[model samples]
Target chain A: MARQPLRKVGSTWKPPGKPAGQAQAQDPAGSKGEAALVAGLRAGDAKAFEEVVLRYGPRLLIVGRRILGNEEDARDCVQETFLATHRSIGEFQGRSNLGTWLRRIVTNAALMKLRARRTRPEESIEEFLPKYDPNLFRGGPRNANALTPEELLQRADTRKLVQEAIDRIPGSYRTVLLLRDFEGYSTQETAQLLDTTDGAIKVRLHRARTAMKELLAPLFDEELR
Target chain B: MREFLLKLLLQFRGDKDPGPTEQRVGSWMLRHLPGMLTCPEFEEFIHDYYEGLLSAKVRRRFETHMQLCPMCQVHFDSYVRAIALGRQVCSDDEQLPEGMPQELVAAILLARNQDLDS
Candidate 1:
């Protein structure tokens, strides 16, 4: 198979020595798999419950982290998610993938905790992207008036700018963006985890990236100007 | 290109197992060089829109903004590719548990085979 290129934007794709250890697409558990697990749990098969728990544990942790914001709270959220999952197995009805169902339970648990603590929504959607003003940096692409090495170094400092911008974003936008963008959750999965619609996930993601860009305006000023 | 870099940095900031959020975001942005050459407006929308968080109206506005912005479209594409690559990296590194949960597997099998009458 032709290796996928890790091309930079505006550049044609080129094959780099393939980097290793990529995660696979998340496959929802089949009905048969769910049925088996449900049967085992219903039959008081302790081992079966353990299997389900093990399979879904890390994902549960990731979802919990987004909502709870700390590993300790996230761990508690995972436990609660499983406990609820076990209690509700008989009633699962196989309507959704087991992982989706579990994620729903975990998200609800974390949201409830967030609500109880009155965790404030951190940044508005517009504020999530990094900030830059185009009028200030209106030089055309061919202009080479400002390429001194030291000044160029400042323009190169993109990572720092991007980081600071993310730091400024509201926690709600951060969570959704991280889950969808960083953690590789599908819009549907994110919606399930966030208890929102897929349309909502797309909007949050778009806004979050835009806000991040705004936050990093200084980084762009040197390069674009 | 500028938008693409931001999207990559935004979504995959932590996946490199970067020690901190700051480090992750910084490292990712630095890695994608020269792409920032283009001045992109979608970048502004990305950061500004997020400050408002999750109001229903903001969601609508964000969508509307994307529909109108060409730069954001390119950024969105890069963001998606970066995500796919990150997942690939994570998947290859993960170590599966030694065996399938035997009890869980058995339970699922039993459930599938079970007849209410039996």
Candidate 2:
């Protein structure tokens, strides 16, 4: 059967108009196209391989950069991901979309790089949590309404500050945060990728969030002032 | 309200009047208020609270606690900001510094072809 070309959807591979609840009802044509592409990749068709690279390279690079925190390392990880994918194409079950499978590969590659590059001891997140007084409240009651995160996020500088704060979190907690929160991976997926339990992912996510908030509290406080 | 009395007492104690920012921060601290949840209790339920997984009774309790607790409110706000930052950084619209590098493609294809030949 002649295969249709995979539609170049948006920058990411999300179905354009389908709501998230309809994820189980994938577009038949799109699925057929991806199945054909997978077959071609398995057969070592050069065109199919090139198409995958061109389509997914930028997106994977962004994932690498965010997790690895630098262009050089990110590029290396993306390249490694492609190489790994090419070698392991036969093992890819059709359970997930090709893009999602590739994302998982890229995440793994980036996380490996991150682990190798880490030399510092992990830091405790306790200091980042809010300290309570005898009354169990840090600050007394008042009438000022701090801006919502959505409001602060509208400012480009605030976005940059938030990004910087994310970067400062220790790698152990940071990776869990990135995979679960940033990459939108489920706790189960993140746990599998990181080789931990879902319970651990939940704990780390909470601590990571608390630490992140601590890092940004000063900036938010400044904005409120 | 008890909070109003506390503010009055601070003034009588010859403490400088609380600044607008301090007052604002203080307003969130509902610890002395009835139905207030302690910080530890808030932390225990916060994730479930955010995810909307808590039962209605628990959710109501959590909301009541947030209403009375300034510190938990701040904690929740910061938690939200952290998630937002991650989303923004990882957003698909984030442009690569330089478009995809040609050398990367060339290298991958070369490596793959070499593997094929072998």
Candidate 3:
């Protein structure tokens, strides 16, 4: 007997539950819309490509700005991100959320830009970290008093100060701090994004947090008094 | 005799005490402080402690040490504040800068369309 070719059950393949285009049209940035967006991109649908850029372009630029710290470089990074995503859309396995995948791409692009621009010798993080005595007791200025109501009222300014302090840290630690603390990426995710070990991520995160505290100590101590 | 009189007058005026010079670690805390973990050791575990990754035994010891060591406590508090501030700054979506550049969008679309054609 001659063998007969078997036909697949469904003519059209879609992600489990709900058509992607409809869901995405209702809420473009939501995860439900991601499948349809991915499908459209895979199919080379011009409208899908336009929608992806229109929806995520501004947010991705913000991410790039945070990492690169310059408007022009950030813009360049985001541009590269969209182009790279377009070229590599076929390789996107949908293992992570679309936003996360895009974020990882932008982070890598910004880091590359930063690396290319690092012509001078980088400064040591020690200067920004807290000093400890021989016994390992922190020896910097102390503030035993908690934040008062008046001090708490300056939270907005404090946030800006914190962002400034973050910008001052060395790029290596700064990236880790931004990804882990600012972006709320898990240690594992940050490590994967940076192509480093989990242990390295944890160590850098600890040092970065400690350095940030040291940098902000003067401001906080003044408020305490 | 003059010094004694001044001290007595200050006491009577309720100004002799310098007030509490910040909260010192109580004697009870000192008695319970971990003898094994030094400041450096405790410092190394701070990240794990904050992330809730420390084992129960280590966490107990770290907490005990924190109770007795005002310096470490202050460091820990500052670390917490730093994390909180970072989160606060990051979460304030209002601080997001202006929208994406128009030219960049056009460039991306052009590149993507060219790729599709090829």
Candidate 4:
């Protein structure tokens, strides 16, 4: 007869009344709250996971939309991102801000999705073209004397032009610019998210900005003069 | 004062590389061009004067320079194009290619969660 395995159920599992992670503890002493929550999560406390989702859901949504270029996909990415984050909570090495680590995961997920759905083959030359020519403006002095707001809206179509320029950038460069310029991530933050060095992010961002400058030249030719 | 200003302007002069001046201007332009150039108010009257957005008095003076200045014209045109293109590329309304289905989001999440549990 083999010895019966010890059935120490009550000790290994959390108390029935305790909130699933470190969150139920006192107000976090500095970073201790997050640390506690992470610990609870490691212990399989479900509530700790919920707190993580609540904290990051909105920020991640914006990131997803910018990366994926659509609202619905962004929302989907957030949900999946949190779930994945939850699964890997045990292995989280605590070497980074949880937000940064989670963001890295979300960014990778978004990139993977883009890669999977993209129709173009990897490394195709045609993917590098400026998506639209910036010469859409009719050549002529815009009638400046027309002072009405409606007239300006009709003639300028400023919003549409901006979108077209963004569309024209190559994929990697485009994502870098979007993260830096639109989403307001720092060079270091973006580097972490993309899993690249800060030097690489800087180089890519410079190229993106230069490309953006070319696209915008026609619009501002008059202003700079 | 006018003589000093002219000397300063000469360092940014269109005919030559202006070397360091161009780099400074490039950095300044990168940050501010988006806001400064997008106004239709400036775009409408840009062609009447070579330096489209300069004050009338300033434009009157630059006009004389531009008459013989091909470099200024080309550089100015390139800047204009860049601002216009920047606005277009970053605009929000641009459509995305079709995305993963809602079901896929669920499937992926569920699969990941299950893996964690196991």
- In model 3, the Cα lDDT at residue A77 comes to 89
Chain B vs. true chain B: TM-score per candidate:
0.35, 0.63, 0.65, 0.35
lDDT of 4 at A78: 80
Error of 1 at B65 (Å): 14
lDDT (Cα, tens digit) per residue for candidate 2, span A1-225: 211111211122121121121112233238777888889899989998988887777777878887888989898888888888899999999888877777778888888887787788777777776566775555422222356566766766876777788888888998888777777777788899889999898888888887887777665563363
Candidate 2 C-alpha lDDT tens digits along B1-118? 6446445634543334344454454445454556556767778776666565678777666665554444565566556656665565556344444467899889888888888789
The residue-level lDDT of candidate 3 at A42 comes to 89
- Model 4 regions lying over 4 Å from their true place: A1-33, A121-164, A179-204, A218-225, B1-118
Better of 1 and 3 by TM-score: 3
lDDT: the better of candidates 2 and 4 = 2
Chain A only: TM-score per candidate: 0.59, 0.78, 0.76, 0.57
Please give, for residues B66-102, the per-residue lDDT of candidate 1 as tens digits: 3223234334433333333333333332443433334
Clashing pairs in 3: none
Which DockQ values do the candidates obtain, in the order shown?
0.06, 0.24, 0.22, 0.09
Off by over 4 Å in 3: A1-28, A134-136, A148-156, A222-225, B1-36, B94-98, B116-118
TM-score of 1: 0.48
lDDT of each: 0.51, 0.67, 0.68, 0.51
lDDT of 3 by residue, A126-220 (tens): 88656667545657533344663236437556766777889888888998988777776677877887889999999999888888888777655
**What is the RMSD of candidate 1?**
14.4
Per-residue lDDT tens digits of candidate 3, residues B1-118? 4334333433443422112221232222334343446667788888888877788778766765654455676677767767676666665642466555788889888877777689
